[model samples]
Target: MVKATINNFESLALSGKTLGSISYATRKSVGRKSETDVAQVNLNESLETFSIQPQSGFDFSTSMGTKLKLVNARLVATEARSNGRTSVVQGVQGSLLPVSDPTVDEYDEAEYDMVFVTGKNRKPVARVRSKDAFDSQDLVLFGSDVLYKTDNRNQVIIEDDEAQKSGYRLNFVQSKIKDDEIGHLISIIISVDEYERLAPSLKPSQKYVPQGLRVAFVGNETTNWTLYADTVVPLTENNKQAVKVDSKPNSNTAVKADEKDMKK
Candidate 1:
């Protein structure tokens, strides 16, 4: 027989006390009852060999093994493989719980491709593709506000800085507009390569625009619009032309407006 001292009252069988004693039979029987029922005899022997002691908290131990403490309200076992053999080993959960791995949550290149278009068009114009496909009636945003809809077909592409360096290309269609109707100014955000190729013909007076500046193109005209390094001047409520100011500052001039106050 083995004697164990209970230190915690959490167990319903040993409640309302700081310490108590429980006896267990450790010896195995040498008779027919024991031979016919091996499982029960082994279970009783294991229960007697292991002891539970409570100090600051409960600690469980077998006579020949190290004590194990409960973690996250449960006991966990971990295994590692090496040289075609698997072995249970101690792990970080006992020391560092709730760990995070950044690589596990990172997006793959295929996922990035799903969000943008990759192709060619007849015209030399640049194109912007969104990770999401938009319908003609769907509203598209330039920065923080909606600038136009897919129906206009003049929206520009905005590529991430890292993505531009990878030589990804987009497709743009030539604008078709009637000569009688007033032409609308369409703006696009593009990579540096696309901007350099089209900049010469567009003849934007200012060559150095802000990193994410939008290049505005006149409807049907294709290559006639001013390029300024100033903040992106959004189109007016009528979507006819960009709202600008006449003042020029050091060659980098743009029509200015209270961007915050402008409505979508």
Candidate 2:
């Protein structure tokens, strides 16, 4: 019953100072120009410029420096080189800010940002923070919105006892996120390790009814995060009436398939 937080790597806020002009994302790799059905918006934060691809069609009276928020955003990897598809964010919706700065509290309670890093940094990433990452979260997958194949590729590193998969991220969300309440679609880059550590006990959530997968994070602040897997919590007839359940629908947002020649 916990509300998902925004600190997860799969969710992000773009253009700290308001960034861009929205335009159609097109591809010329399929032997002809084609529309991606998503808009490409470039934004800036702290002087860092980034281009984000969000599902288009929502009208925003966007001008320069308009703070934007994108949900269900993640990077997708492709094994082939001819798909002409860039790593995209599965943004259900992108809205203007005042949606709240994703942090410890509502308003600007705390700040969050990301970048590609290569170093043994301080505090195991966010251990240096006053609030631990995902301290206020209890993720549960109600079901997949659309579970099908696509043109994305994944690479998992398997070692002696475990493995880490980081090709497509698992995106979770609140059953009914309010339009103005700053709902966040958390995309956890969970590895196999998270699945190993957490056990399912059927401790019901106050925010979400027990229906699909009771998810958990595998790591801590010290080691950052590892696996993101579902726990086994079976519902019974005696208590089934008390819980609002969701059908175990298949789910998968990113599925980059093998790339090939100029034909599908």
Candidate 3:
């Protein structure tokens, strides 16, 4: 059995230096459209905020996890007008810096004074006052994160036929099960494609268990059991039809369906 821990697990992020889990996301559409249009033909914009908490004893200066240190960081709200215009409104102002950088002399002056704003809102999103030094009081910082349009297609390449066949194979086994432990050892097998498809619909913190799905084991309970689907076809109707036609007893249905049905 393989051992796994959260230490090496990588988390998914939309873009650019995520501090922590995304706490909030807001989308707005603002623009003018003609009478024939169903809705306003405006620019689609989104504003996301991430809660960044400094690790207790982790030194930001030496750690790779901590990307940027912002002192005198402020939260601002901006809105796009329907008349092709935008406005910025300042909200709150405070510092969120690295604990090691109590004095502002560690980082370059220009880097510390830089402020970035999202295209949707023209407000001062975050201020990078110092890279290394931060006040102890500024333990938590809210970063106004921005999301940009990205291609969502999977770009994996299966080098050979064998590799392609094994690309979607996934196995499950309990870790740290001792030889003498009198416990039921359960294992589940699934395809990577199916897992990816079902993962988005599941809760963020949900776990997949064979028992939860009411799966039963056959044969000797002492031995490990594995289950897998034959093959996963693409969810599109065209792909389903292709698979069905390929698996049919006879492959002579080249004629139109109406002609074949009439003959039958």
Using TM-score, give the best candidate's number: 2
Cα error of candidate 3 at position 171, Å: 6.3
Q: What's the CA RMSD of model 1 in angstroms?
A: 30.2
What candidate 1 gets wrong by more than 4 Å, as runs, is: 1-182, 188-221, 233-246, 251-264
User: Which runs in model 2 stand beyond 4 Å of their true positions?
Assistant: 1-173, 177-187, 202-264
- Minimal lDDT window, size 10, model 3: 255-264
TM-score of every model?
0.15, 0.25, 0.17
What is the full ranking by TM-score, best candidate first? 2, 3, 1
Candidate 1 on 70-139: residue-level lDDT in tens? 1221111234455656544211111111113122212222221111111111111111211122111112
lDDT of 2 by residue, 86-201 (tens): 33222222332333646222223122222211121111111011112232234444322111222335333355655433222344454445423333443333223333333243
Model 1, poorest ten-residue lDDT window?
A: 7-16
RMSD of each: 30.2, 14.9, 23.9
Best by lDDT: 2
Collision pairs in model 3? 72-95, 101-133, 101-134, 112-128
Error of 1 at 207 (Å): 25
Query: Residues 1-264, candidate 3, lDDT per residue (tens digit)?
Result: 433211111111111111222221222223223111111111112234443322234232443333333333333232224455443322222233443555443334333322332322222233332112111111111111111122224222245532222112222222333423322122222334544564445332122322111011111222211122222222344432222211111112111111011011
Q: How large an RMSD does model 3 have? A: 23.9
